[model samples]
Target: MPRNLPLFIAFRLLFNARYYYPIFAVIQLDYGLTLPQFAILNTIWAVSIVLLEVPSGALADRIGRKRMVVIAAVLMVAEMALLAFVPLGSNSIVFWAWVLNRILSGAAEAAASGADEALAYDSIPKEERETVWPRVLSRLMHLTSITFVFVMLVGAAVYDPELVNRVLDWLGSDLVLAKETVLRFPIYLTLLHAVAAVAVTLSMREPPLETECGGEASLWSGILAAGRWIVHTPAVCGLILGALVHDSVLRLFTVTASEYYRLIGIPVAWFGVIGAVFAGLGLLVPRLAEGLVRTGTPRNNFRIVSLISLVGLAGVSLAIPLWGVVVAMSFRFAFGLLNYFTSHYLNAAVDSRHRATVLSFRGLALNLGFGILTLFYGGLLRVLRDGNPVEGGNDPAYRESLFWMPAIFVVLWIGWWYHQHRRVHEARP
Candidate 1:
């Protein structure tokens, strides 16, 4: 039941995200903001995360993890509800609302990140966390993928930015009712957030706290100490680096990939179908990763999976069709092979004493990846759009997204493989 909870929540998020995604895209259109404006908003979102990641985790330490998660869940529900109802079409109100939601979400997330990791770490015996962590995340995400795929089909059928106003016109409905109808998807999305918050509150059991000294240290001191600890282990640093790239690629797909599909003339409903196709791969690949782990270290399986994933991603970077995103997701799931592996590295490398501090930086590393990805993608979009990148959505520039992500995958994989090899030799009798 406990393991099933995260998977259920993951699906809920994707289901919810589908509704807001278009809302996010169309709000800019509604407000007379261009693509650049959207990018700027996203940039702000990323910055909020990057700035707050460590501090938020530290807050978790101070106030306790469960409190922060509950708070985060509350913020998510409020934020989504506010977006679904309020008409902020051309005002700073919408922008600031977005910013506030993201910051709060970050704070809430910070509390949970370490706590969740720690919780899962504790669920299994100390020896098993290495093996169990990846499976746990994969299983949850896999369950989420199946849930989201179906939800995507539903979302694609219902919530559409392009035809939303048109449907409203035909129904001859009042604007308020029409808008509320359009926002239904997000309301359900908010419900999912509430559900996740509740789940964490009730179902989650705390991981055994580390005996590490960082628990009592000042925030800055803890953060610096964690950084120092990270670089000392090849597998640990590799895991952190891989997570950043992994998140970047996934967010890029999550934030803008569907819009690109619509631009290419894939039907809106079809977009949801494609969502299933991509996410469906999530269900398949983690099981395969679990199979691979029976024989290899997390690092070894990571190398094998990363190489295959890069190949798949390269196809994604090249294809212009909606199916390309499907292919991209295929590769993306393959990379997940290392999640459990690297999780093991982090768990093993950190003494119980400073676990949350080091783990907070783990969250920080991933957020930094998210920040860099947005800036790069935003700049790339701007460049592709002839210096008016913010002038609303540009269909032609969607393919340009293919260029940046694949190369980064290559560089990170090579670095990770080298480190793994060196570590293996060092451990020899």
Candidate 2:
């Protein structure tokens, strides 16, 4: 029960619970950026994260984890400031500002990815970890879900000028805000959270390294060593592989959730409410995950998660109006469970020496898998579009894509499971 534990939870809440998340795409588009430009900016963000993920983790191992966490917090402040204060108009400058912002944001994400969790996990006494860590994780998840619901609701509400003006009127304010003026409101709120994260990170005490090998290794050597360790360690490798399968597909659906909602007869205005509901649902996940971890083996837990995903995806494919939202929402449970299980298992298996780097590898694999899936999805959409000009809209392609996702996940999961099983079988004495 060190101070780092609570600070770690607070830092995660502040660092990740960005108010702009609910209206991310809309804010960018409202800033005069076209959809194509928005897409390109996101691509840049993803590439930056992929490129920096492992290197940052390696550096965190060499340097202090607290140092990296502080750097990430500073970068977050800078990124949010770019959005908070960039002047309207001047398209070229604004676009470039966003580009720089994305790069900074990605770097921040990479720096914080493994270092924060590793730092916190290392703070606990070794003897108490197995019994205590699950409870800590469960508490963190519950708090995070509450924070997300608050952010989603407040963020979406403030993004609308009319909504803000109504509040102002009730408070006897004479000033009225315009759409452009209020568009940055969410960014401003996120900036405050970023600042709070910096304070929390600054206050954190870096626990003594559990392994002598942490600071002595070269960056390249550290990464290579971690890579080799993962390959040879069946449990760790299997955890990452299983996480990759679940994360990439679920994330793809999560990102395109708005379109899915529209197709399922949900109005655009209710999107924020739906998001809040989803976040609220996250409150139930940590308890269930804890119970599963206590009673079930990793194989059994993964099987349960796989079943939930398969059923949810199949139901989504049916595209039942309004009712399909429930099915779509079930993926949240699968996703939450997957995240908790992977974190618990991966951290438990990896050594403290290469902990951050291995976690970074997990992040890198998940991102790469998502990127590949996104490209495949794009190709699938194009093929669907070319095959039938009558249904020129994207809705048909989206439906077709939904229909195939579950099938694709099944094939991939089977292959992954078989490969892991073979590796285990061969390694046995």
Candidate 3:
């Protein structure tokens, strides 16, 4: 493996995801799909990932992380290619193509989920692993935020009709070709990002690991062992529960945030501006949370950060003005801390042989939470939107629907974490 394999992995992640995610909700709406329809699509993606997450993790541990990542990158390219070619709207063929694309995307997500982290952890020198791993995670977060800011600006610009028309005119495109180009440009751009990620993944090598990395056992046996470990391990189970609860609301917020901005009176074109601002603030989070990561127990960190996140979610759900929304969103700075500490804690608890498999258990829990929410929420959103149109930032039903339930979930999650924390400490010596 090259000395800079981590850098290459970072490069692939930096390019592979940012371009599409910032504009994802917008793309779905532009496709003439309602929120509920989009939620169903998300459910499909979650279901696909749920089915494959553990198996793929075990496969990565058995075969190699690099191979799994390469496979993921190829799947991503195929997914984007499907999206790029399919015309927008509720046409039967386009809808089915989008579904297929989401299924492939889910598979790609599962393949890469645990393998990247496991590979990165092993790649570090043993003597420096403790100190270096946090820094690597922090840098990765910072770089990812920076990439997000760049792509938000670029994606928003390209998706702007005026700019697209300007570019078409500069290229001397006929009116018909220009219209066609504008319609397809975003997907085409995303396809390029996917191809680049594949190239970058191909350039990297898997880090070496112990011979018994996935255990000298059958794949099913490996998975069973990992399941047993998760059930028996307090730290692992607690972390997974905490992550599922906290991330469920966060995931819902992410899916609807662009639309949330519109509901709060911010123009759609300015969504990128808000994203850039949030991403900039998000860059500072790992540094701000470093004290907790280095000095506090995982339970204590979760207690503190989960409280802060709960407050933010409440404000996001209740805030009435654009400035209020921006401030409320900024309150979510603790998100990165929650993410970092959970992964770090879980990694420390699990052994190397079953690390990927156990990590996939966490992914499974998350998808189950996400899928359930999407199904229940999708139907409700379908009803709310159909009855009341969103305009002039006064669609209380739609806006409330997005925030109220998630807020309730966060509150309940906070209580659950507090109980778990108390139980863990009480049981200690």
The top-ranked prediction according to lDDT is 2
Error of 3 at 256 (Å): 0.7
- Greater TM-score among 1 and 3 belongs to 3
Could you list the CA RMSD of all candidates, in the order they appear? 4.6, 2.8, 3.0
TM-score: the better of candidates 1 and 2: 2
Selected candidate, larger lDDT, 1 vs 3: 3
Model 1, backbone clash pairs (residues 3+ apart or across chains), number: 11
lDDT of 1 by residue, 1-429 (tens): 346346334523532344444334643444445566676676676666677767666655544454555555565666566556655554577666666656665555555566555544555666665655666666666776676666656565556544666676789965534443554564566556565656555554444444332444565676676677777766677678776766666566556665666555566546666766666767776667667766677656755766666676677667655555556565446545555555656776776545655777787787677777777778887777674343334456756666667886677657656766787798789
lDDT per residue, candidate 3, 1-429, as tens digits?
A: 335446544644544545545567777766666566688899999999999999998888888887887888788889988877776545676678878988998998899878767776777777777777777777777876777677777776676677767777888986534434554566777788778777777777676656554454667788888898787677677789888887776777777777777777787667777777777777888887777777887768877877777667766777576875664564447667777887777876777777777888898889878888878778777677776876654655667685665455756586766867776887799
Tell me model 3's lDDT, rounded to 2 decimals. 0.74
How many clashes (backbone N, Cα, C below 3 Å) per candidate? 11, 0, 0
Best by TM-score: 2
Candidate 2 C-alpha error for residue 151, in Å:
0.8
Backbone clash tally (model 3): 0
**What lDDT does candidate 1 reach at residue 158?**
57
lDDT of 1 at 409: 68
